[model samples]
Target: MAGVYDFTAKSLAGEDMALKRFEGQVLLIANTASACGFTPQYRGLEALHQALGPRGFSVLGFPCNQFGGQEPGDAKQIEEFCASNYAITFPMFAKIDVNGNNAHPLFNYLTNQKYGLLGRSIKWNFTKFLVDRSGKVVARHAPTAKPEALFREIEALL
Candidate 1:
């Protein structure tokens, strides 16, 4: 019966962050990459964070290099890239695998709560999991599903 609140992950700053901190907030948890074709989605994701943050919603980005080695940068580099390019103000986590045996536990829990077209395994960068205020996984979005396209669903949850 564990929910998203039960997991912890390292922040991009290298500090352990308990997911419980976001317990009552609606969340869009995405496996992100700096060099992927969808990297531009960061802007939309940031917009969502800024626009809905005051309403108890947030976006959590987790950098992953498993897809085409697109996000090979170290923590500092990743932080710099996001700030310079997207002005990303949302919380971002340190680089971690999003598939196979080494996938982060948070991601494992996310994928388990909602299966994608490829089953529980993540198929690419930008795969997103939406969690409601109660920490229940509500939907799973594909890499092709732009962040902006999720606004309606997110708003409803809020």
Candidate 2:
């Protein structure tokens, strides 16, 4: 996939959600882990989503346990954690492997479009990809990068 709209992903409900749902919008696609040091970024993400969502921008959170198995919970548990802890309102997808041969195709496409500090492979959970309204991956952010730090580019897209 060359752009966010070029892909589809399983929602927490296990239903196929087309990336086209975000057409003409800026999207922040992130691989998250409840136990990762960057887990707290969820708050910032939620803030961004709420603040910019009305302006045609969104944040999509995908849980991944591949890195050190940081996100080991099932769907329900993950949902509970995100709600109770971070009050996350953005969409969250099922657990996916973000590394190795079993990596999700969407992530594979994202990494190729925007390499991280560690190159194509994502270094850890919370790594983020910014997709412009055209669906193309525009930037790759390290796990430590704060969500608030991305507002400028996201606004530019909007």
Candidate 3:
């Protein structure tokens, strides 16, 4: 019964972060890209973080370049883009593969917990997973699913 808390990943700042630190908090875990059509969703995700963060909610963004090579920047570049463009205050992690053999362990666990419309592999960037306070994958949101659409579910978990 491995939960999300059982994982660890490197942050955009290059620090090892244990997912257990987020235990008991509702999480919106999204695989992000800087140059995609859905890149603008960062703003909405920031808004969600601002609105619900104090109520035990957090949005964790993981930059992924697997899709169209849209996120081909290094960690520093990604951090600067997110800060300058979206003023994103939420946590963003290092770039990692979201599919294929070299996928990050956290993502591997996530997809195993809940499949997307296209099946086990993530169809595109910005694919989101909503995790409850107990670290269970509660819902899987497609890349097209707007950040605002997750408010009700987040509120319920809060």
Candidate 4:
């Protein structure tokens, strides 16, 4: 079976990022937006990255505009917004679709590994997928699931 490491995504800077680089690290992969109700979650996500990054844990943010066009920004805008507003230091990917036929491959794999409450399709922005050190999908968190709520699961993986 293919693992999370098998995927590669474009960074906000337009560089191809191989997920294999994060092998053996616990990951919190989240679909993010800039102008949504859950946009404030970026702060908590950054907090988690800052607090746990030294321990082989990291948060990967992927900007998605599929929901209400909340993240309707180009790479530069998204990057600047994240940096200035939330001081997001973790890696943020280029904008991409998180649902429908054009969904990114990584998200497609994620949904297949762990479906949401209603179904596999991501319900909204900020939906999170917790991946263990071995690249296994450990849990799927809803958009409303606070980043702090993931501490225990991340600690167990670490």
Q: Compute each candidate's TM-score over C-alphas.
A: 0.98, 0.96, 0.98, 0.98
lDDT, candidate 1, 37-107, per-residue tens: 99999999999999999999999999999999999899999999999999999999999998889989888
Q: Which stretches of model 1 miss by more than 4 angstroms? A: none
lDDT agreement with native, every candidate = 0.95, 0.89, 0.95, 0.95
Kindly give the number of clashing pairs for every candidate: 0, 2, 0, 0
Give the per-residue lDDT digits (tens) of candidate 4, residues 10-124.
9999999999999999999999999999999999999999999999999999999999999988999999999899999999999999889999999999999999987999999
What tens-digit string does per-residue lDDT give for candidate 3 at 53-130?
999999999999999999999999999999999999999999999899999999999999999887899999999999
Off by over 4 Å in 4: none
How well does model 4 score by local distance difference test? 0.95
What TM-score, to 2 decimals, does candidate 2 have? 0.96
Model 3 / residue 115 / CA error / Å: 0.8
Report residue 79 deviation for candidate 4 (angstroms). Answer: 0.5
- Work out candidate 2's RMSD over C-alphas: 1.1
